[model samples]
Target: MYLYGASGHGKVIAEIAEELNISITGFIDGNADIESILDYRVIANNADGLEGKAVISIGSNKIRKLIALRDNQFDYVKLISKKANVSKRAIVEEGTVVMMGATVNSDVQIGKHCIINTNASVDHDCMIEDYVHISPNVGLAGNVEVGEGTHIGIGACVIQGIKIGKWCTIGAGSVIIKDIPDYAVVVGNPGKVIKYNEIQKLSQ
Candidate 1:
């Protein structure tokens, strides 16, 4: 296995790789300044030697998607921690990672390049779209639907059957009860939208 980054996100994935006992060949980083990560050597760019399966250890949804799209020569590896409790019925797509202590209940569908962070709980039948990040300690009740590229902040709670739209951000410690619209930045105890179309605009 190889990692496509060597920064903080890469460090977390390196730990996951170690936990899984997967031997990392090296990290393919563009930055020449980065020498090594936790004793693993950093190769300057993928052309140096990287091939076959690798994971893009980037935290940004936009950059991760871009890298996935741009790099078709190498296969993307999905890194699911052994410590995570993912039901056999759950469907986790390629390039996604279910971190340690995370719980993915029955029939949950996690899309490509998504991050089900440490200690997050995704309840039964939840649909997490592509590039979404369910941050550490986040909770999603049964049948909740998260749109593509949306971010559920750490410690946030999504009530049962709530639908969160694409590119939206649910602030940390917020309680989501109502459906959020696209590109909305929601926060507070009932998850009110503090901003709208801002995320989309920034992306554009």
Candidate 2:
């Protein structure tokens, strides 16, 4: 599998690779012209050899897309770190990464292309929809439902049995104590709706 991103997030993902004993070919980044990520060289510019099995390490949604547009050849591979605790009852779909120190409890369903970042915990019965990103140190209590394309911020915490809507953005360090509406931007202790995301259609 190939890692797509050579800088910060890629570094973290590489550590995860080490823990899992998986072989990573190299990285794909726009910033650095440098050959190697620690020890591996950045070869295959278009990433033709590793399509559909490479792990994308792009942090933000925008950057992820940018890199994907640059070289959409590599299919992002999913990585579940060895240190992470994933229950047998949990279901994580393809192209999703469960990073190091994270815990996914029983009966949790994670959708496609989602990123469950480092140290995050998703308790039992949580349904995380597609393209959602649960950042580092985020915690979701039991039966929490996160909608599609929602990006939970770093260090955020969601209470039990809450339903966060689609395309919602939870602010960093915020505590979500209520149900969020679709396309809402939520923040602070109670996680109020600060703004609503305008829905845009992608080109076919």
Candidate 3:
């Protein structure tokens, strides 16, 4: 399998693949200048005509979504690290990456092309939509709903039954105790809405 995006994120994915004994053909990068990562050759500026499975390996939810939507040729694979504690009852869709030390509890529904980053804890009955990024050490309580393209930053904690809307950004170390609206940029202990992401709104 090939990992798209030759960066630090891609290196993590490569490590996970190695842990699973999966053979990596190389990396596929948009930047021509990036020749290699972890001694693996990088195919620059072209995903076309590449056979076999691939993982996006991008940290950015928006970029990951855009690449998945734009490049439909390669078969996208869901990557779950061997060290991850994923419940059998969880439904993780294709193109999603569950990183090492992550814990996904029962009845969690994680959508396509999502990132459940290292050591993240997603409690039971959570619904994580497509392109969502649950950053390292983040915690989501039971029944928390994270909408499409939303990014929950590192070490952030969301309370039970909270609904985080689409394209929202929950800042690092934020404590979310209430429902977040669409395109909102939230931060602080109570996770106040610092601003709406006008750039994301305009892109849509």
Candidate 4:
């Protein structure tokens, strides 16, 4: 399989794949100067277009990951770390990576290009949408639904059945007890929205 992006996150993804005994083709980062970071060679801009599987392997939820999939028809690829414990009944879609020590319980449905970082625990029946990033040591209770492009910061916790909306950012160590709206920036204990995501508007 081919891995996209040669940044620090890409290196981690590469390492995880190696540990899992998956065949890695190479990386495709926009920055072409990345020669041999993590002892992996970067192929270049437009990824080699090889006739094989590929993973986004990115960690930046701030920049929407769907952008990388535009017009590309590579089949979805799901990767679970060898050290992670994922229930066989759980449905993890392509372009998703479950990092080391992460535990995904039964009935969990994780969407494309989502990152479940190291030591994160996702309870049973949770729904995580596309491009969502669950940071290191995060925890989500049962039945929680994380919307597209949402970012759960490191050490954050979300109560059961809470609906975190699209592109929302939950700050580190925040405890989310209520539903969060799309594009909201939330932080602190009992997490509350601090600001709206103005970056999308600025880009438009």
Candidate 5:
């Protein structure tokens, strides 16, 4: 396996791969300055001629999506840390990474390229769409539905059955008790829509 994006995120994924005993061929990055990470050779801007599986180790949802869509040669692989407690009934799609100490309960469906970050708790029957990032220590109650490209920040909590819309950002340390709309930027306890992300709307 190879990791794209030779940065901090890639380093973490590399460690997860190590725990799983998966052989990492190298690291690939667009940045020419990054020569190596953790002793693995960094191939700069040359994804051509590469075969086998790879993971986009980028933290940004948009960048992950962009790379996945643009790079067609390599098959994406899901990396679930050996230390993570993922239920057998949970469905985690390709290119997704479940970090160490994360808990994914039964009947959860996590989409492609999503990040279930370290120590995050995803309760039963949750639906997490593509490119979503459930940051470290975030908690999602049972049956919560998080949309595509949405980012639930570190230590955020979402109540049961709440539907967070696409491209929304739930701020770090916030508590979400209500449903959120698309492109909304939510914060504070009980999570209010402080503002709409007009830039996201324009991009989409």
Candidate 6:
């Protein structure tokens, strides 16, 4: 297996790969300055002649998507940490990474290229869409639904039955008790919309 992006996120993914007994061929990154990471040879992201499965170790949902597009020729693989408690009933898609100590309960459907970060708990029957980032230590009650490209920040809590819309960001440490709309940036106990995602406009 080959790991992409030889940064901090890559290091964690490498550790997870080690725990899974997955042999890593090397690391790849767009940055030319990094020659080696954790004693593994770091080559240019576009370097050729390497084959086999690859994982995108980037933390940012946007950047990960960009990098995945750049390396679309390679077969993307999922990275689930051995330490994570993922139920057999859950469905995790390709290119997603479930970090160590994360708990994914029964009937959870996590989409492609997501980051279920360390210690995050996603309760039963939750639906997480593509390119979402459930940040470290976040909590989602049963049946909660997160839309595509949404970012649930670190330590955030989402109540059961709440539907967060596409491209929204639930700020760090916030408590979500209500539904959030598309392109909204929300924070605080009730998780109000502080601002709309202006980038969504440009994309359209």
TM-score for each of the candidates: 0.93, 0.86, 0.97, 0.92, 0.97, 0.95
In order, candidate lDDTs are 0.89, 0.82, 0.94, 0.84, 0.94, 0.90
lDDT of 3 by residue, 4-92 (tens): 89999999999999998899999999899999899999999898888789899989888888888888888899999989999999999
User: Which TM-score value belongs to model 6?
Assistant: 0.95
Q: Rank the candidates by TM-score, best first.
A: 3, 5, 6, 1, 4, 2
Superposed by TM-score, candidate 2 places the C-alpha of residue 81 at a distance from the truth, in angstroms, of 1.1
Shift of residue 8 alpha carbon in model 2, Å:
0.9
Instruction: Please estimate how well model 2 matches the true structure, expressed as its whole-model Cα lDDT.
Output: 0.82
Candidate 3 minimal-lDDT segment of 10 residues: 195-204
Question: In candidate 5, what are the lDDT values of residues 1-204, reduced to their tens digit?
Answer: 999999999999999999999999999999999889999999999898897899999999988988888887889999999999999999999999999999999999999999999999999999999999999999999999999999999999999999999989999999999999998999999789999877644354
Give a tens-digit lDDT track for model 6, residues 62-102: 77777777668788889899899999999999999999999
Better of 2 and 5 by TM-score: 5
What lDDT score is found at residue 28 in candidate 1?
82
lDDT of 6 at 20: 91
Distance from true location, Cα of 30 in model 5, Å? 1.4
Off by over 4 Å in 6: 47-49, 200-204
Worst 10 residues of 5 by lDDT: 195-204
Candidate 4, residues 48-147, lDDT tens digits: the string is 4455677887677644365455626666577889999999989998788999999999999998889999999999999999889999999999999999
- Per-residue lDDT tens digits for candidate 1, residues 1-204, read 888889987888889989999899888888999889899999886543447888888888877787788886788878999999999999999889899999999999999999999999999999999999999999999999999989889999999999999988899999999999988999999889987756655364
Candidate 4 vs candidate 6, lDDT winner: 6
Alpha-carbon RMSD, each predicted model: 1.8, 2.7, 1.2, 2.0, 1.2, 1.6
